[model samples]
Target chain A: MAVLNMVSALNQAFGGEMERDPSVVVLGEDVGRDGGVFRVTEGLLDRFGADRVVDTPLAEMAIAGMAVGMALNGLRPVAEIQFMGFSYLTLSTMISHASRMRNRTRSGMHVPMVMRMPYGAGVKALEHHSESMEALFVQVPGLKVVVPSTPREAKGLLISSIRDPDPVVFLEPTRSYRLMKEEVEEESFTIPLGEARQVREGDDITVVGWGAMMPLIEKAVGSVGKKGIECDVLDLRTLSPMDSTAVLSSVRKTGRCVIVQEAPRNCGVAAELIARINEGALLSLEAPVERVTAPDIVVPLPQGEGHYYITPGRIENAIERVANF
Target chain B: MLIDDYDPLKKRMLQVLDQEGKVVNPSLEPVLDPDVLMRAYRTMVLARQIDDKAVILQRQGRLGAYPPNRGQEAASLGPAMAIGKDDWLVWAFRELAGLLWKGLDPLRLYLYWMGNEEGSHYPPGLKVLPAVIPVGSQLPIAVGMAYASMIRREGTVTLSYCGDGATSAGDFHEALNSAGTFRTPNVFVIQNNQWAISMPRNRQTAAPTLAQKAVAYGFPGIMVDGNDVLAMYMATQEAVGRARRGEGPTLIEAYTYRMGNHTTSDDAKKYRLEEELKEWEKRDPLVRLKAYLMNRGMLDERQEETILGEAKEETERIVVEAERFPRPTVDDVFKHTYAQMPRTLTEQLERCRRLEGGGR
Candidate 1:
């Protein structure tokens, strides 16, 4: 085991995959000589050479569209979008074509590629640098969306996403990139998509969240527990193929559920989980699933985000409301 | 030999076998082996049969819609037959004939016109991409594939087929520019069949000729009579040879006329004059080919009738076989999106299946 922060873990995973497969390539702005803005690809260009660690022009659509063609031909491209906010330029190819290529072609082909972007707002960044728009990708077909909360899981999930025989949108929590360090496996492994990790077990209520909100949910669970309220906490590792079984099981066990997210509330994954709960576990004898989410507004700057965003206190309050109901 | 010195763009549309079925330039004539010529004829006949079957099927309510290639058989089949099977092909909507020339199955062709997505699925190693419905979109993809092949030293050339209207798209320019800059092995064939649905050629492009557009991309461009199968075949063969020899890309403008309505759903009477349509009918590829074969003492009236009758029978058999394959399930649409279903898609699959009574 090695103690690695999220950024270092990403560097290791990229280097490891490149070493394992000669066809695996990393392409994006400043990904070559500069080793990326966050150093997520540090030392990769030096190790793999410029061909494999391509420093492409500042064109997201070409970067993504060209990757689609590469994946279709033979290479497994791992593209970096710098930030989740910049992904809008690439979504036409991603959503209209990449997502529908397999379906439109009737299983004739696959786009086995991964796009990694840092997401969420909390670390006091400028405008458009931080956004949690995982739900937008969730709406598209033929694409898988992943959001990992920790260093250990981040490396493993990324490796799996690259190996997936379809296009994957891997969302990295920018706020948690270097916020903490944890011991991760030295050898590469894949944490299967669509599975959730139970961070804490309780009997009173279930707290579900993913990406940047996972740590906050865990902290809220502990705070609620100190008040004699036992709360279950689940970290949804994959947002698109959400671990519905894990979520519903936790909801069924506690008879109360509160879904939290950093993205705006309306039409978010939280709303999706609420609908699934009503459809799958209606007889589980629980109150309506509450959602602790950001308001339906654009991600504000760091100064205003503190006022608008949900915190552990906010999550803890939502747990109380759901448990009392 | 002077044969190797002939350029499709600089020289006259080279025709070794004259329209009267006589060897006009016997020395310049290609030494096409007997098997290759037969194969070319078979593919051309197959393409026509498929188009005729699609048209009748749409009228009978057996197919949802069809973009028939009735008047453009020679334009597609000629170039498709000129290339090797391992070479790559990217096609637009009206090029089923080209697909058939590259060994695409008749059953799948029927399935495609019947509105099933699975019909476009080519088997592995065939190197033919699925049909691109958004016209001209496949050009960039073809260029990308050619670039990859060049980088890997695969020695494979890619042929991208599109209509004259496709030349007006930004993607076409991007693909041509990138391919030229990289000197990738690619051939862009513009089947300028005179009409793009209801829009005439004059309205579609200001350039005097589609082939001239290739000059801007730093490549030689040629204009050949699309109805002359032999001319189209010879020009394509030269282009493919150049690409394989690392000479980079070429743009070929097959100047022909659309002899039918744009598609089964189209009404050409709303756009073009009856006199213009009648003029193109005289230049039909099948009529020209039949006349040539008759003059060569290779085909008689009796043989021609037999050929037409067998073509109709073969098409009916294929349609019957195609419609028998089970309709694609909704789950099939979600499969292969990724090798395995991702968690998010699994949830969607479950929801859809549940709504459909858990059948799929």
Candidate 2:
């Protein structure tokens, strides 16, 4: 196993997949000689040649739409959206064609491709660089949403998404791109989608979180342990096909649940999780499921973001509210 | 039929059987062998039977609503025979006869009208896309396929078949513009059957002729007597060969008529004249083809009876098979939504299943 950060792991995954299948091609702004804005595709152009590792124009629509047409012709395209904010422009093409091709054609055609975008707050970047908008895609019927919190999961899940026979939106939380690191395999491998990873096990209560909030949940879980509260922590790696079974089972055992997400509270993934548990494990619950999420507002500047976003202290307090209820 | 002195266009257009019975063409005469002629007649007969059965099934509440191709059989089959089996054919809703020419199972088409998504699934390498309902959307897709073929240096050509109303759509312009710029291997066939539902051709466009619109797109445009099977086949063959030889796309406007209501739900009597129906009745494509064959001493009354008898029996067998085909499950509706089912829909499916006591 080799220890690598998110950028390095992504580079290895791209290199491995491109070598494994010549059909795989990467296209985005500055992904060639510049190796992408974040260097995630570093040295890929030299290894795979410029034809396959394309440095496309700075047009997100062209990058995404052309990938759709290319995928329709039997090529596996991995397009980079650079940032979540810039990804909004690609939504129309994705929803109109890529998502509905199978249904509209009555399963006569399939789009095998992936749209990779980096998103999250707390990176102290420019405007549109950090925005958590995975929830926007959650409502789309045919799109699978995957958010990896760790480098190991990033490479594996990305490979799996690329190889999968459908279109996928892979959101990489930029805050954790360098902050979180783990040992990953040199050989190519894939992690099955729609499955959750149990980060920690306990019996008193359950803490469910995903993406950029995983580390904060970890910290809160440790602090709550000092208060003698045994908490089960689950990292929901996949958002679209949420692990309802694992979540409900954990809530049933603890008789309580606290959900965490970086998106706004009103209509975020946490809201959906709470509704699922309320509907499924109503008898098993000792109290209402609590959600520790960002308020319904635009992600604030780095200085005041601590108040608007979910933090370790806020999660700790929410966990206590459910435990003491 | 009105057998009298008329204009040359009308005289050349309103044909019923040659003096013999086989269909004939003037501009480019194609030698039709016994086998080819039988195949063409069989496909035409099968297409009509399928359209008739489908409309009745819809009326009887057995199949979903559909657009019927009652009078334009040769407009679809004539060109369908011009292309190779491996060539791609992108269709709008009114080209049911083209499916038979592409060797699609009649039962599968019936299943589709029965509301099963699986109805559009053709065999591997058949190169036929499912029916496109949004009118001209398939035009750009056909252009894209042709462009890709050009990039790969493949000899394949794409043929797009649509109706007169589709010419008004923006997608049609995009496709034509792209084909013009790239000079891609493609043939655009417009089945101008006079009316788009209740709206007539004059309402759909102000242009003198639909074929003439192709000149702006840098392609030759030809108006054929759609009711004349020989003229349509010869015209399409010339255009298709031109495309295959890298000359670029051509627009073929087959001038035909809609003999019946647009679909079962429509009542042509509400908007059309009873006298107009009689006028087009004299130009029946099938009758003209039979007369042409008879004029060439190729067919007789006994052969016509045998052919129609075989076509009817085959249609009956297909109708029985289509009726016997099993229904798809509710879960099957959720399946194949994507290459793999999305998680959001999976949960929705589970909720529905749990409510239905976990059933099909």
Best by TM-score: 1
Which pairs in model 1 have colliding backbones? A240-B344, A241-B343, A241-B344
Q: Per-residue lDDT of A1-325 in model 2, one digit per residue for the tens?
A: 9999988898899999999998788877889899998899999999988657767656665566556655766578898999999998677657766777777556778778899999988887777787998888887877789999889889999999999888899999898888967899999999998899999999999999988899999999999999999999998898877788889989989999999988877788988898889878989999789998778888878777766766799999999999999
Encode model 2's per-residue lDDT on B42-105: one tens digit a residue. 6777788778877887888988887788779888888888888757888887887777988888
Docking class of 1: acceptable
Model 1 bad stretches (over 4 Å): A28-30, A33-39, A54-61, A89-92, A95-97, A100-108, A122-129, A300-308, B1-31, B168-170, B177-182, B201-224, B289-303, B329-360
Cα error of candidate 1 at position B185, Å = 3.0
In model 2, the Cα lDDT at residue B228 comes to: 68
The DockQ scores of all candidates, in the order shown, are 0.38, 0.20
Model 1 agreement with the true structure over B218-242: per-residue lDDT tens digits: 8877877787777778778888888
